[model samples]
Target: MKIRQKSREFIWGIYDFADTIFSMNVVSLYFPLLIVSDLGGKDIYVGLANSISQLLIVLTAPIFGIFSDRTGKRMPLFIISASLCAIGTLAIGFSAELGAILPVVIAFIFANYFYQLSLTFYNSLLPRVGPESRWGKISGLGTALGYVGSIVGMILVMPFNTGKIFGLNTFIPAGGRIATFTPTAILFAIFALPTLIYYLRDERRSKYPVDTVNRHPFKKIWETFSDTRRYPGIRRFIVSRFFFEEGVETAIVFMGVFAEKVMGMPDSAKIVFFVIATTAAVFGSIIWGKITDWLGPHQSLMLVLYGWIIGLIVLAIFPYRWLFYPIGCWIGIMLGGVWTTSRPYLLKIAPAENVGRYFGLYSLSGKAAAITGPLIWGTIILIFSGWNLFAAYRIAVATLAILIAIGTIILMPNKTLFEKHPIV
Candidate 1:
C-alpha cells in the first residue's frame, strides 16, 4: 500500500515536470524571442498575447473548478485541457513558420490559455497525492522536478533553435525559434502520458454526482465568492497573491526580452543564464518546502515574498551586465519558493471538501494578475519608450518591485490567520 501510494505521488509530480517543458520553451524562452526579436514585433505584442490568454483563463477557471468539484473528478478535465494545450502549441509553430505574426500570436493566446487553465485541475490533485502532513514536501518535490524539466527542456530544444546541442555540432540543423514549438508540444504530450495513464487505470469515480441543479455558472461563481467568508484566511491570501503574482508573472514573461535588450545577452548566453537560474531554483524549492513544513506555510510564504521584494529592487537598480547573472539566480530562487510555499499555504487554509472550488479561486487570483501584469508592463514600456531604453526597462522593473512590496504589506497581518487554526 505504501509503495502504491508513493508511485501515485511520483506520477503526480511527473506531470509538473511535463508541463514546465512547455512553459520553459514556449512561454519563457523561444516564443517571446520569436515574437519580438525574429518577427519584428514589439514588447507590447508579447505582453498583449500573454494578457489575452490569461484573461481567458480568468474568465473560465472558476467555472471549470466548480464543474470539477461538482463532478467529483479532476483527471478527465486535466487530460482534456492538457491535450488541447499541446495542440495549440503545435499550431503556434505552424503559424510562426508562415511568418504571419497575427496567426502566431493568436495561436499563442489559445495555447497559453489552456495551459494556464489546466493548472487549476493539476493543483487540485495535491490532496490526493499524499497525507496533509506531507503536502509541503510533495509540492516542493514537484516544483524542484519542474525546474529540472526547464533545464532539460532548454537543452533539448537548443538544437532546434541553434542547430547545436550543448554548443556542439549536431545533425539537426538550426531551425530558428519556430523549431522549438513542435518538439516542446510533443514533449509535453509524451511526458504527461504517465500521469494520464495512471489516472485512467486507477482513478476511482467520485461519489458525488454532478450538480445539475445549480446550472447557472454565474450563480455558482457568486456562491463560491460568498463561501469564502466562511474560510478565514482564504480571502486575504488570495488578495495578497494577486499583487505578488502580478509582479512575478510579469517578470517571467519579460525576463528573456529584458536580457536581450537591456543587458545585451545573446541567445546562447541567455540559455546558460537560465540553466544557472533554474539550478538555483531547484535547490530553493527543495529548501523552501522543508521550511514550509517546519515554519508553516504562511510564515514560509511571508519570507518568500520578502525575498521577492528585495530581489526585484536589486534587479531594477543594478547597472552592470555581470550583475544580471546573480540576480537571475536570486529571482529563480524566489520564483520556486513562491509556488512551493503558496500551494501548500492554500491547502493548509482551505476546507478539504471544497478544494477544487478554492483552487479555482486560487487560479483566478493568479490569472487575473497575469492578465493585468503584462498589460501594466507593456504600458510602462510604452510610456518610457522615448527615454533611454535601459532606463525604460529599469523603471519597469522598479514598478514590479513596488507591486511586490504592496503584496508583502497586505500579507503581513494574515500571520494571525493561521495561528488560530493550526494545521495538524
Candidate 2:
C-alpha cells in the first residue's frame, strides 16, 4: 500500500478505537446502569431504547448510504454524524437535570442513532482504504485497538462512577449521571477530531456512477434488496447473519443487566468484569483475525459460533459467581471473532461496484437484529420477571443460543460462498 492509504488505515483504526470506547463505556455498559439505577428507570428501558435506536437505523441508514453514493462523498457525512453524536451525548448529560426519563432516553437515542448511522460510511471506506488481501489484518488491528480503547475508556470513567476522582458528585436523586456523560462526550469528541480532520484529505470517494437526479430513496433501497437474488451466497449469509446477530446483539446489550440482576454484582464489579473481558478480546481479535485469513471466513466463523454456544450455555447454567471469571474470557474471545470474521467475509463476497449499497444493506440487516434481539430479550424478561428474575435471564440467553445455532446451521452449507455458481 502507498503511504497515504496506509495513513488512512491508521487514522480510521484510531477512529474505530474511539468509537468502540464510546460504545463499550457508554452504550454497552454504563448507559443501562444509568437508566435503571440513576434515572429510576426500569430494566426493560435498556432493551426498549436499543430497539428504538436500531429501528431508526434500519429506517434511515440506507437513505444516507444512497445519498452518499449519489453525492460521491462520505467523509463529509461522517463528520456531520460525529458532531451530532457529541451534541446528542451532551444533551443526555444535561437531561438528568430535567428530572425526566423521557428526555434522557430521547437524548441517548439521538446520540446512539448518529453513532451507528455513521458506520455505514465508515464500513464503505474499508474496500477503498487498503488492498483487499490485507483487509482482514487492517480490520483485526482496528478491532484490537478498539478493545484497547474499551479498557482505557473503562479506566477513565471509573473515578467518576465511584465518586473517587476530581471529587465529582454527579449522582442522581442528588445531582445526576453527568460525570459519566460529560467525560464520555469530551473523550468521544477529542478522539473523533483526528478522523474528521484527516479523513477529508483521503481520496476514497465513491466509484459507483452517481445518480444525481435519483428520487424515491426508499424505493431505491427496496430495489437494492430485491437485487440480492442475483447473489445467493451473499444473500444466504446475510439472512443467516440476521438471525445470529440478534442473539449476539441481545446478549451483549443485556450482559451488564444480566450481571447486575442475576449475579447480584454492584457497579464496581461490573467495571472490573468488563475490563478483564475486554483484555481477553484484544488477544481474540489478533489471534482469530489470523485464523480468519488462513481458514477463510466460513471455517473461522464456525469455530467462533461454537465458542459462542459454549459461552452462552456456561453463562446460563453456571451457578457460582467464581465461574463467571473464566466465562467472561470466553465471551470476549467470541465477541472479537464474530466481528473480525464477518466483515471480511462480506468484503470477499460483495461486488466491488456496489460496496456502499451492500454494506448499507449489511447495516440494515444488523439493525434488524438489533430490533428483534432486544425486543425479544425484553419481552422475555418482562414475562418471566413476574415468576423469577433469574429465570427470565436464563430463558433469554437460551433463546439467543437457539438463534445462534440456527444461523450456524444455515451458514454451514456455504463452503463456496465466494465462488460463482450457475444461477439457473
Which residue pairs of candidate 1 clash?
A: none
Clashes of each: 0, 0
* Candidate 2 all-Cα RMSD: 3.8
lDDT of 1 by residue, 1-424 (tens): 4998888888888888888899988898988999989999988899999989998988889999988888778778888999999999999999988997899999999999988988998898888778888899889999998999889889988999999976898899899888889999988999889987786555574343344445577788888788778888888889999999999999988889999999888889999999999999999999999988888898888888888888889888895678988988998898889999999999988888778888989999999999889889888888898877889899999999889888888888778776733432
Q: Which ten residues in a row have the lowest lDDT in candidate 2?
A: 167-176
For model 2 the TM-score comes to 0.92
Candidate 2 lDDT, 1-424, residue by residue in tens: 5897777777877877778867887788878877877777776788888889999999988888888877778888888988898888888878877777888889888999999988888888777667887778777877887888888877777776676423345343322245677778888888877777776765453353455657688888987788788866788788889988999988778888788888898877887888899899989998888887777777788788889988888778873579887899898989988888888888888776667778888899898999889889889988998998788888888889889988888887777663332121
Per-prediction TM-score, please? Answer: 0.96, 0.92
How far off is residue 174 in model 2, in Å?
12
lDDT assessment of candidate 1: 0.87
